[model samples]
Target: MEDHQLSKSLQSIGKSCFVKNFELFSDAAISDLDAMQFLMDDQGYEQTGARTRVREGRRIIESGRAKDALKIIADARLEDSTLADKAYRLSL
Candidate 1:
């Protein structure tokens, strides 16, 4: 899939999972998987702007920066429309 398509898919999955009230830890797992898939599917994405943000957010989470991760996710959700829905549904 193209970068935009993958991004859309990720956003959609995030929103759907959030709406279903998936736990933060679970959602984080899904996000991690998606990130890996993105990496495997597209090498050029590593230098892209969106990918940079995604990596940063993932790093924050992996580092146990919960509050910062929450903030980063919140900001990302705001930019991706579907993210807010998921954030609202997941309460995270």
Candidate 2:
């Protein structure tokens, strides 16, 4: 698949996985840097945006800014209801 197609497909898969298994995947965590590297290598997906968000959210969680991550995910949910539902459910 073309890069655009791959990007879209990966995004879709990410969204779906989040919706379906976010509870298991949540905890406001960022996967290891090696995991991010693997994603970039295997999928050619850029991790800067998503990884940065996850890292920042993780920091907030660590710093007792738990609500910050909630707000960010809530805003994301508003932009994408499916993703929002997944995120909200994961948050619980």
On lDDT, the leading prediction is 2
Per-model C-alpha lDDT, please? 0.44, 0.46
Model 2 per-residue lDDT tens digits across residues 1-92 = 34354334335445433343333224534354754464466556578844643343333345543433444454553556776765565456
lDDT tens digits by residue: candidate 1, 3-79: 45444544543433322232433356566556545544653334353344455445433555434333434556355
Task: Name the runs in model 1 displaced over 4 angstroms.
Answer: 1-51, 71-80
| lDDT measured at residue 12 in model 1 versus the true structure, 0 to 100 | 41
**All candidates' TM-scores?**
0.33, 0.41
Q: What is the lDDT of residue 82 in candidate 1?
A: 72
Error of 1 at 88 (Å): 3.2
Q: Which candidate is the best by TM-score?
A: 2
